[model samples]
Target: MVDSPDAFGRLWADDYPGDFLRDLAELGDRMSGRPGERRAAELVADAFRDAGAREVAVEPFEMNAWKRGSTEFGVTNPVERSFEALALPYSPSGDVHGDIVDVGHGTPEEIEAADVAGNVVVASTETPPGMDRLYHRMEKFGHAVAAGASAFVFANHKQGQLPPTGALRFDREAAVPAVGVSAETGTWLREYADRDGEVSLSVSADTVPGEGHNATGVFGPETDEEVVVLAHHDGHDIAEAALDNGCGVATVVAIARILGDIDLDTRVRVVTVGGEEVGLLGASALADTIESERMRSVVNVDGAGRYRTLRAFTHGTPAFEGVLDSVSDAASREVSVDDALHPFSDHWPFLKREVPAVQLHSVTPERGRGWGHTHADTWDKTDARNVREHGMLAALLVRELTRKSVPRPDADALAADLESRGLRPGMEAAEIWPAHWE
Candidate 1:
C-alpha cells in the first residue's frame, strides 16, 4: 500500500485545480500558435515556479499553424437556406459547389460505398455503436479526401445546436475544404440530400509557419531516471476549452504542488504543452530531444477531471494497471482501467519509442467528445470537487509509478499490437503513420 502524503490531504482541503482551470479559461482561446497559447505557456511556467519546481523553462519549436477565418455553408437547391458553421483547422480556403452526400458515420467502408466523388460529403462525429475502436475525425476526413470529395462537412451527432471543431489533418492544410455544423443543420442537410439537393461551401483560412511552446519543470530526487507528467495547454479557438484541456493542465499544476512537498526516490518532470489542438506538436518536439531510455513512464492528464470517476488507458502496459489498482485501493476511489493502445493523445510520441505510458481521462458513457470541442465547453460545466478528487488520485498514481519498476513494451510487439487492433489503416489514411512502419 502507498502511504498518503500530507500534501495530498492539503489538496482535498483546497480547490487548487479548479482555480488554475479558471485562470487558464480567462486567457481566452488558447489555440495553437496564437498569442493566447504563448500566454498560457508563461502562466504554466509561473505556476511551476510557484510550486517549487526546478529548471522551469518554456521551450519553443517551429510548426505549421492554422488560423481560422470565415466559413459559410448553404443549401443552394431544393429550398435554399443558410446555416452556421465553423472551419475545421487545416482546412484550405476554397469555394466549391456540389451535390450533398451523407456518409452516415464516415467509416472507410461507408465512404467507399457512398461514391462521394465530386460531391460535398457529410459525416457524423460519432462512430457506429459496438465498433472495436473509436474512429477519429481525421480518419473520416482522410477517407473523404481519398474518395475525391470536393468538400467535407463534420456533423455533430449530439443535439443542442452545438457544432464540433477539430483538425482535418495534422500540421498541414487538408486536400479539401472542411467545416462543422450543428446537429440541427446536419439533419436539415440530410433531409435536403434525400430530395437531391445541392449545396455551396466556402471556407477561408490561413496556414503558415509558426511556433509553439512547452513549459517544463522537474522535481523529486536527483536520480537519472525520471517519470514524465504532462498535459496539453492548447485548445480550439471556438470555446473556452475548459473541459477539453483547461482541466488537464490545471490537474498537472495541482499535482506538481503536491509533489513539491513529498519525499521521492525518482525524478519527476512536469510539462504543459501547446499545439495539442492542431496536433501533438509540442509533445513530439519534446520527445525528440529527451532520452527515452532514462524515462520510467509517462502519466498524461488529458481528460481526467471531467467526471467523478477516472479512466486510465494503459496502452497495453500491465504494470500500469497494477499502479492504478494501488492508487485506487489507497485512495479508496474507483479508477477504471483499459489496456488498449490509443495512438491519438500526447502520450503517443513517447509510447512510439517503447516507453510505458498511461493517459488519464474521465469515464463517460458518451462515445465522442461530448462538449469538448463545442462552444458549450465552458468553465462552469466542470466541478471543483472532481478536480480535487481526481487530482489527488493522479498524484498518487504518479508517485507510485516513480517507485515501481515498469518494463517498456518491445518495439516490434508494440507495432504488431497496433496493426492487430486495426489502427494502421486509419493511421495511414490520416498521414500520421510513421515512415519506419512502411
Candidate 2:
C-alpha cells in the first residue's frame, strides 16, 4: 500500500497551487501562438526549475494558428435583431445567409434527420439526455459539415449571457464558418426558427502559421521508462481561463514539488503544453519525440482541480483503474474512476500511440462545460482547496504508477473499445480518427 502524506497541511501552508494559478491568470490571454502563451511557458519552466526538476526546457513547434475577429449574427428576414457571437477558432472569414435549422443537441441522429443542407445549423452545447457520453462541439461541427450545412452556430445551454468558444477543427480551417451564442440568444433563435426565419452570419478571422511551446522537465531517478504528468497551459482568449486549464497547469506544478521529494523507480516528466485549446498540438508534438515503449504511463491533469472530488478516466486500462483504487484506499480520498475511453485532452495523443494513460478530471453535476470556454471562466470560480486536494491525489497516483510495471494497451483492443463506445463515428466526422484504425 502506498503511504499517504499530509498533502493538505503541506499545500495549505504555502498555497503554492493557488499562487501559481493566480500568476497564470495574470499573464492575460494565454492563447496558443500568442505572446501570453510564450510567457506562460517561461513561467511554468521557471516553476519546474524551482521545484527541483532537471533539464527543464521549453520546446517549440509549428502550428496552424487562428485569430479571432469581428463576428456578426442576426435575423435578417421577418425580424431584425443581432445576437452577441464569438467566432470559433479555425472559422474562416466568410458571409453566409441561409434559413436557420435547429438541430437539438447536435447529435448524429438529429443532424441526419434534419434538412440542414445549404442552411445554417444551430446546435446546443449540451448533449441529449440518456446519451452515454457528451457529444463534443467538434463532433457537432463535423456533422454539420458532412451534411453540407452552410454554417454552424453553437448555442450554450447554460442560462447565462456568456457565449461559449472552441475550435472548429484541429489545426486546419473548418469547412464552414462557425460561431457561438449565449443561451438566451439560443432561445430567441429557436423561437425565430420556428417562424421559418432566415439569418445572416459574417465572420472575419485569420489563419496563419504560428508556433506552440511545451515546457518540460523531469524528476525522480533516471530510467528508460517515465511517467508523464501533463496539462495544457493554453486557453481560449475569451476569459482568464482559470477553470479551463489554469487550474490544470497549477495542479501539475504542485505535483512536481511533491514528486521532487519522493524517491521513485521511474522518471516523472512534467509537461505544460500549449495549443490544446486550438487542438492537441503541443501534446502531439511532445508525443512524437517519445517512443511508446519508453512511456510507462501518463497522468493528465486537465479538468482535475475544478471540484473537490476527482474523476479519473482510465481509458479502459485495468492497471490504471487499479492504481487509482489503491491511491483512493491509501489516501482515504475517494477518486471516482471511470474505465472509459475519452479521446479528447492532452492524453489522447499518447493514448492513441498505445501508451497507457489516465486523464484526471473532476466530478461536476453539470453535463457540458459549465463555465469552461466562456468569459465566466475566471480565477474567482475556482477554489484553492480543490487544487490542493486534487494535486495530492494526482501526486499519489503518479508515485504509484512509477513503481508499478503496467503493460501497454494493445493497439487493436484500444481501437475496438473506441468503436464500441460509438466514438468512432464522431471521430471520423471530426477527421481525428487514426488512419491505422482503418
The worst-scoring run of ten residues by lDDT in candidate 2 lies at 1-10
**Once superposed on the true structure, which residue ranges of model 1 sit more than 4 Å away at CA?**
1-5
**Local accuracy of candidate 1 as per-residue lDDT tens digits, 1-438:** 234457888888876567888989988788888899999999999989988999999999999989888988899998788999999999999999999999999988999998699999999998788776778999899888988999999999999999899998888999999999999999998898888989999989999999999999998888889999999999999888998998888888888888887767799999999888788999999899889998999998999888889899988687888889999999899999987686788998999888888999999867789998999999998887788888889888888888887889887887788889887888888988778766
RMSD of 2: 1.7
Worst 10 residues of 1 by lDDT: 1-10
What is the per-residue lDDT of model 2 for residues 1-438, given as tens digits with 9 covering 90 to 100? 233355445755657778889999988798998989999999999999988899999999999989888999999977998989999999999999999999998988899999899999899999888877878999999988999999999999998799999998999998899999999999988888888989999999999999999999998888899999999999989899998899889889888877777667788999999999888999999999999899999888899888889999888688777888999998899999887686778899998898988899999878878999999999988888888888878888898998896778888999889889888989999999999878
lDDT of 2: 0.89
Clashes of each: 0, 0
In model 2, what lDDT does residue 403 have? 88
Residue clash pairs of candidate 1: none
The alpha-carbon deviation from the true structure for residue 120 of candidate 2, after best TM-score superposition, in angstroms, is 0.4
In candidate 2, stretches whose alpha carbon ends up further than 4 angstroms from where it belongs are 1-8
State every prediction's TM-score relative to the real structure: 0.97, 0.97
Question: How displaced is residue 218 in candidate 1, in Å?
Answer: 0.9
